[model samples]
Target: MRLLLVEDNLSLADSLTRALNQCGFAVDCMHNGADADQVLRTEDYALVILDLGLPKLDGLEVLRRLRQRRNKVPVLILTAHGSIDERVKGLDLGADDYLTKPCDLTELEARARALIRRSHGFDSAELTFGPLSYDSVSRVFSLPAGPLSLTPREHAVLEVLLMRGGKAVSKDALSEKIFGLDESSSPDAIEIYVHRLRKKLDGSGVAIVTLRGLGYLLETRDAAA
Candidate 1:
């Protein structure tokens, strides 16, 4: 899944970004609320981690504006403000959850998972396609051989394909989702990643099919052939 993290504290943001990325999320980090707002407006996010203390635009306004547009992507407010009133206000303003600063990263991840699960309307932790079983939280892809741990990028690539299951996903689309808007990674970089993924999935009975000029599709070999 993709997450937008709007935090101004450089050290905190950097640490949080790494932690979330390690947990299998493609995270886009912005140091200011204005940039965060722009990213939210332009990109699709599975969840947002927002802080109230921000530059350019206060985080509350960002939440307000997003709600004004009826954007329902789950927002988990993270702030130093732990007052009862502040917490109530954030919830009233449509935040899915709230976490105080200096909080445990594990707890933050748990909240994120809960929000994402609620947003997707899915109760199970495993996503299955044919013989493949993916655990979104653990970042493991299981098959007949046993569980295989994936690098964050590999997980991001597979997550998109698996989530769409039977669809043709364009290379450009995959690039954007995996690398974000300011991607310096070339199309060749994406191909390299796909090639590695294909080899891993090859002969494993889970199909990751390539369609020249169109894009790539993931399905059973029988379905594709």
Candidate 2:
């Protein structure tokens, strides 16, 4: 999954970006709220980690514009100001969650994961499709036979597919989610990962089907028939 980290504090932004990347998230960072706001309007993100004290534009105004335009991407506000009014104001402006500065890394990651799950309408970290099961927290993919070992890229691809349920996911969408906004990736790279996943899941009763011009969809072999 990809996340936008809009924070001006260099040290904190660097640390958070590194940690989020280690946790299997593709992260893009912006220091100014204006740039962040524009990026949010143009790109897709699993979530946004926004700091209130941003340059150029206030974070609250950016969020307000996002909500006014009806962009429902989950936003987690990060601020040093922990006043009740500040928290309530952010919520009123459509922030999905809020975290005070000097927060624990583990707790922040957990909260981000929870927000992503909720945004996708999933109440739990486990997502199951046919005989395939994935635990988001453990980053484990399993079949009826056993747990399936996957490369990082393969896991990222499968995460997008499973999260979309049975719906088709476009190549561009998958690319952005897996590669992040700043990374340059070819469609062939995504194909290689998908091909590898297909092999690993060959006899697992689940299949990744390409829809030619449309995209790819995960389907059970029986359902395909």
Task: Indicate which candidate wins on lDDT.
Answer: 2
lDDT of 2 by residue, 103-214 (tens): 9999899999999988988898888999999898988999988999998899999988988888999888899888876788886788899999999999779999999888
lDDT of 1 by residue, 80-180 (tens): 98999988888888999999999999999988987886675556777788888877677689987898656667777887788776687788778777775
* RMSD over all Cα atoms, model 2: 1.5
TM-score versus the correct structure, for each prediction:
0.83, 0.96
Lowest lDDT block of 10, candidate 2: 216-225
**Total backbone collisions, model 1:** 0
Off by over 4 Å in 1: 149-151, 180-183, 210-214, 221-225
Cα-based lDDT for every prediction: 0.83, 0.91
Candidate 1, 222: how far from true, in Å? Answer: 4.6
Model 1 residue 181 lDDT score? 53
